[model samples]
Target: MQRRYVVVIVALLIVAGAGGLLVTGVCRVRELAARMNCMSHLKQWAFALHNSADTFPVERNEKQVSAFLSGTIPNADLPPEQRLSWLVSALPYMEQSHVFLQIDSTRGAGDPRNQRPIENRFEHLICPSSGEYDRSSRTWKSAGPLTHYVGVAGVGADAAALPLGHPKAGVFGYDRRTAIPNDIPDGTSNTLLLIETSQNPGHWAFGGPATVRGLVPESAPYLGDDRPFGGWHGNHTVWSSKKSHYCIVALADGAVHSLTNATAPEILEALATVAGKESLPANW
Candidate 1:
């Protein structure tokens, strides 16, 4: 009986160890999958932006584009959540044609035509590695208007009127250096475009102008901001390894690559300017 009891205890211990390993493996695999999916989501949006730029002239007036499109410039007139919210616009390209049709561009938020919830609860928007998605409520409150990706505007507010001046104004759109055509002699891959942003509620630190109305001041600390208990998982923050190491950027050549972060301040500054090619470091 004593021998049998000892054997049972040993077996239990082995079972527990195996279970622990299995759980650990599963978590790691899930995390990797989430990151890959996020990258894929970014690629889809990048292609969409490329297509939009192709349709619109690079040097065209920003206000004119907004007026022609009815105040829905992806990066210009539109707010952050709605600005880079190309998940609706790029639906067809990403094998989600049905969702795109649901968005009534003419109707504002409270319109009767806005029947289907504007927020997309699709698993694609939710990063499996992070807890941005509220599974119970089926909403994404971190960044406004139900989104997974974030935009990077190079030019500030005053510079939006200048050609390719403000790349950091809205989500997804880059400055002239990164957004314009490659043959134009003004472009760089190291400059930021759209990065994966954390969806923080109330204080949207990373959201662009569109989400400006709902965002808290950047002075707010991340401590009590109770979304989850982890560091930033996306490329926007300094904490992100993927972004600081090799950020995936869409280039002027209409190509995308994971670029090295070992870039000079001048290089980064040049990339921020619309006429970066004229001023950027030759070696960059």
Candidate 2:
């Protein structure tokens, strides 16, 4: 009986060890899959932007009718013909043309008539990684419009915050350097375009943080690590890697790159600018 008991104990221990390894493997894959999904979203948006850029010099009537929003202009003072974000405009390119048509471009996105598109839960665009959400409500959507990614408006809160005569040096925002893909003097692969974040991502159809965001450095404590513990994830703190130490960003070339949280602020600045001409660190 003693020998039999010893054998059973050893068998149980082996099974537990195997189970632990299997669980660890599954968790690692889950994180990797989430990261891939995040990257895929960035690529889809970037390709749409590229297609939009290809067909520029659009007619004023076309812009107003199609709700084809522009991010290069600063709408706060001299707003565009339509106060829509380019995300709405690029819907057609992303194969989501139906959602684009639902919006009544005759008025602002907040117009009562445009509620369907504005409040829509574009599941494909939502980040599978992190955000404050309630899965227990038997709901799989955000209360309002949500976007996990935003256009990089150079290295500030937005393009308007840059110094006078300074280029927006980004693909989107008030004074963007790359209105067309060719405008990126620093090479498309070397520039930052759309980046993923769990910060206070404003409305999807409306303007503001919903569309363009500035690439600020000095992210000593990326909120992703502490946010799951109930800290405020607001104040424009960028969070791409949920419960992680890295962030995912897409370049003008439609390539997604994983950046470690420890990446230098200057390196980030270099990538954000269109013509900074700053060299990256070795092996970066």
Candidate 3:
């Protein structure tokens, strides 16, 4: 009788352990699926950007095309700074056909016609791995999420002058591999174009921290706490694991990799410069 009781106890313990393992495995699989989806989202975006460049009109006369559309044209009625966001242009190619139709590019950005609620199809803005942010304050969070991706704004306003009249100047567009594909005098690949980032504007707002400066005319809504793209946070979690690490960026080359907090600041700077890729340190 004693032997039978001991045997039953052992079997029950074994079953419980296996059950725990099974639950953990299922969670990991879900996490991995989400990350893969985010990666696919970025890869598709990069391709769309390339296509836009191939199709958009190109004119050599600086300040001819709307400066909002081309970095090469500067100090015009509409500065290159006023250009439509690359994300907005990518709607159709992203399988967001409905969204593309809703946006009215002909109207001014501030026009009420441009605003679309998340239910209207903007939920696609978020990434599974990135969490939401607190709008009342600029900070990291896990609620009220917005997007799981972000856009690269070039190095700074100073660098903007270099590609001043080129169609792809304000950003590290696909042509970053080459100068506006023959327009700009000098351009280089391995130069950072689009990078994977959490859409939390609080941390990574276009200009900088909100405390340091006020919001820009174009980015006020995004900076709102209700939106998730308020901070500059990144993701760093092990494959098949539930725990998350800091920011990890997806490169224009379709490479999804980690960018640790320990990464050198110069490495990011080097990746941003149109010419910096040529002089990359051998160690990197």
Candidate 4:
């Protein structure tokens, strides 16, 4: 009887160990799949921005572009009337032409017609790793729909203060000038274009100029401010406080790269600028 009991105990322990390994493997696979999907989404966004620039060249200053696209110039002086986000302008290239057509260019993002598209949830814009979507907890706070990705505004002490027409060296600007390939003197592959965040300030269609200031460290404390550069996963301090260890970013060349929480803030800032003429790190 004693021998039989020992044998059964050993068998159960072996089964338990095998189950633990299997679960670990499955979780790893799922995490990898999520990362890939997120990268794919970033690629699509980069391509779409390129397509938009190709079709609508940035011929004039930021004010001119804003006037042409949104029928008004966005600036700190007139905060309430400022509308038209970069995402809305790129909708046609994103396979959202029908939705784009519905948007009234003459009206601001708050307009009823423009709000229609913003209110809808877009799965492609949501990061699967971020887990289930919750409209109630959007970063924009009832402004419109929420997004997990945002553009790098620029790298400087006053990055956030720059008006729409005069954006810093980043790929995207507020309803400002559209950046063509020629604008990025630092090489497209080396410049950062878009980044993922658990919390985003503007809706995909609202065109409120969603951007991240590269001044803060990638792993900086959140402080509940939605304007800084950071993510929900990894070392970022936002929403649920869970750590995912890495943040996803897309370069101007439409290439996706994974940035760990420990990546140097200087490297991130360098990548955020368009004409800063900075060199990438050895590993980057």
Q: Give the per-residue lDDT of model 4 (tens digit) for 28-56.
A: 67777877888898889878876655565
Q: In candidate 1, what residue range of length 10 has the lowest lDDT sum?
A: 64-73
Q: For model 2, how does the per-residue alpha-carbon lDDT over 68-149 read when each residue is reduced to its tens digit?
A: 1256333454353236666777788888888888976656665678777767666556666664343456355556767777
lDDT per residue (tens digit) for residues 1-284 in model 1: 99999999999999998997777667656655656665676666667656655555433444322100111224454444333233444455656667667766544433456445454455554444456666678765454444434344444443322343333332233223233533233543444344433434222112234322111224222111132111333333322334323334344333444433454434544454434444554566
lDDT of each: 0.42, 0.62, 0.42, 0.62
What TM-score would every model get versus the actual structure? Answer: 0.53, 0.75, 0.56, 0.75
Report the lDDT of model 4 for residue 47: 83
- Alpha-carbon RMSD to native, per candidate: 8.3, 6.9, 9.1, 6.3
Q: What is the lDDT of residue 264 in candidate 4?
A: 67
Order candidates by lDDT, high to low: 2, 4, 3, 1
Estimate the overall C-alpha local distance difference test score of candidate 2.
Answer: 0.62
Q: How many backbone clashes does every candidate have?
A: 14, 0, 28, 5
lDDT of 3 by residue, 172-279 (tens): 331222324343222424444445443333211111221011112233232212322222333324334433333434444445554444444545555544433335
